[model samples]
Target chain A: MKRRLLLVSNSTLHGGGYLQHCQQQIQDFFGKNVKRILFVPYALHDRDAYTKTARDKFKTLGYEVDSVHETPDPVDAVRKAEGIFIGGGNTFRLLKALYDSKLVTEIRKRVLEDGIPYMGSSAGTNVSTISINTTNDMPIVYPPTFAAIGLVPFNINPHFLDADPNSKHMGETREQRIVQYHEELDTPCVLGLREGSMLLVEGNKATLLGSTKARLFQRGKQTTEHDPGSDLSFLLTEAQ
Target chain B: MKRRLLLVSNSTLHGGGYLQHCQQQIQDFFGKNVKRILFVPYALHDRDAYTKTARDKFKTLGYEVDSVHETPDPVDAVRKAEGIFIGGGNTFRLLKALYDSKLVTEIRKRVLEDGIPYMGSSAGTNVSTISINTTNDMPIVYPPTFAAIGLVPFNINPHFLDADPNSKHMGETREQRIVQYHEELDTPCVLGLREGSMLLVEGNKATLLGSTKARLFQRGKQTTEHDPGSDLSFLLTEAQ
Candidate 1:
């Protein structure tokens, strides 16, 4: 079975309700077959509050949400989940929690082999890539390793922002940091998903979703912008 | 013997030459007694280029610069050095190289035990703290541990900037990220060292040196601002 994934750049936009804009996309991706979603709220600091927020959001979309934290066995929950949803928060904490629960391999197997639909936003989207090396979050905690689920070929830098032309700040811009990453690690392109943007994957077909353009970065090459409807499926086969 | 440290937030200002703004402080930190200094260029991508830059800058300040990478025995060079300097680059790379060369312990002993004057900028300054947890650089590579030299009691977030009130970016501000860090690990305080700022340490006395104010963050406490020339020696004793 081919895999399906919805990688969102952020859960809430400025002055927007939680996952409000992406509700239609969420409904379209899962269809009517996925009646229940096993939510992973590990990225959040307050897991109970995060789970409740997600539960309320999914309920409005006509689906029952069961958070993995409330489950007796998270691994078993993933094994039987019709779909999985990982919310956004600190990427380090989320990755550490995933490792601590030993859900890395199980999630990969469920999504890649079993064809269970998977969805993640922000830090959630960050961990769906090959590694969490490109995250913008502070290293509040160190994980055993930088490796992630590797469901996608390239790394995702969610909540990507363009440099302010009039700013006086001397810190590196997001583009410069991504360029530095390429300078150190030659392979693996970085996809900069701006706010209100997302990537949709179905089998081998990957498409850019939402209104904003996504920026793509590779070593020794100029960054290119892709429009919302453009096909990014080629990225799947580029990984070596 | 008392340990002496000069932790600079950046190597250069917006329109200035490398180390141009901090030359006087560099000279004042290492008096006429120090004839030669050892440079650690491992943080940069091009060691030779970075070393030459440091050598040129130090020469103008009347001190001979010898890079550890050029020495046949780096450990021996660190042991006999009068002063040590670490240039700015990616913090993760610098810490990893320090571990790879087994220079962490040697450098620590030389600076903290023997009282050899130590200086570092940007990534260099980030590693001088207890951990590289508050750095703004991308995690291009994973180090064996986030554990650094622990020369200072608190972590330093170098090149820190305040939020732009007019900006529409949805990403977390520098202050917010540091606050999140405290929420996870509450004990250690985070000092937001703006560009052009440096911390001068002599044993237990630490003074904020520069023309701008530095922001300090601690868990459950309001963020405090300290002006230039203010005494921050109290932070040195707050480690427990």
Candidate 2:
């Protein structure tokens, strides 16, 4: 029940530089016991460059990397792992592959049941929950991937915000889309995560991470916004 | 707000072959006001057959036959008509075309806002809700058409139960998916609509249309099932 899970975002990995703030937090959370970081890249391209870059991130943080797909025995790889980090990419692709390979169940057992320290970023975090309902992608891609590792409740609406000003498409705003989801759904929480924000759930307590606010919508009323990093300590201490 | 909005189900036309039980209920719901029947095809090759066949259905019902398309001018077509029934086709394609043409918004205004009785079967019914969050399709096609007219609060997961015994793929059960949706959603209220079931939302009363039951889910609790023909009178009646 004391397993540590760190879900991250991929938007920061773009351009030449990276956001050190989150990476620093990941390192701090894992501490010295974090020897082997399992890098999950089911969300990115099927190419090697993307996977290698994710691997390098952990290497830079002084931990060994094992791409989940490269190994013949994922169970064995996970067994020897100290920390598991799911990198950001297309959540559908990553979740699809994980579901197809039946790796999600293993990861769930390792992290939730067996207390394996785990982490996910972007799509990684999106799939950590029950369903990837809040992903900011075209809804047409149905990746034979429905079931997810129930690491946390609520779908992660990553990179959530008003429509980018530069983009010309007339798609519904993130708020609107989520409102639509809330209109349809009654239980799973929808977390509109800003950049560097996260919901750190340990035991019975769930904490919100990051500097800005996260939006929560329910069935009976309009959405309510909450500032993260505020009184999230309940997440670290609660027992489920 | 009562406007002429026609909803068509592909399963009902052509002598009500696909879903026989729903045909009478659907027709009865529309009563004698249906002015036209536009038979849409699942494939392009079947277009002619549908047009000819649907024209007969329209004639039998003492209505006109009009050619329907994704970009039909609603103001021009439904102006003199009592209703415009859009027969079901591939839900994704029909919806994609509707969305691509930006007709969904106009149609929404006509149907929900203007009070048109828009009815659909299969895909037609599937697309009327907020998003197609509840359709049964392989995740292979990520169409940009998942968006829908904001009619109902909940997404319609049509064809609720897979009656076929020999389906090979093992994903979440429809109930499981909705439950997962509830667990993941911030505010979840999903309706597991069976073939004959519908929510007849008139004024403040959204009565159940068929004899089949609909299921509802909530977070941290067991799922609840509702009987058909029960009074959902408060759903449409209740103010937002």
Q: lDDT of each structure?
A: 0.90, 0.59
Instruction: Return the DockQ of model 2.
Output: 0.03
Cα error, residue A83 of model 1, in Å, equals 0.9
* lDDT for each residue of candidate 1 in B103-188, tens digit (9 for 90 to 100): 99999999889999999999999998999999998888899999999898899999999888976667778887887788785559
Q: For model 2, how does the per-residue alpha-carbon lDDT over B1-64 read when each residue is reduced to its tens digit?
A: 3533222223432223444555565566667866564433431224567666656655655666
TM-score versus the correct structure, for each prediction: 0.96, 0.52
Q: Relative to the true interface, what fraction of contacts does candidate 1 keep?
A: 0.61
Q: Could you say which candidate leads in DockQ?
A: 1
Off by over 4 Å in 2: A11-16, A139-141, A163-169, A232-240, B1-240
C-alpha positional error of residue A210 in candidate 2 after TM-score superposition, expressed in Å: 2.5
Residue-wise lDDT of candidate 1 within A1-240, one digit each (tens)?
478999999898777899997889999998999999999999878899999999999999999999999999999999999999999888998999999999999999999999999999999999999999899988888999989998987899999999878766777789988887887855598999999999999999999998799999977878899999899998888552
Scoring the B chain of model 2 against the true B chain gives a TM-score of 0.76
Cα lDDT of model 2 overall? 0.59
User: lDDT of model 2 at residue A113?
Assistant: 76
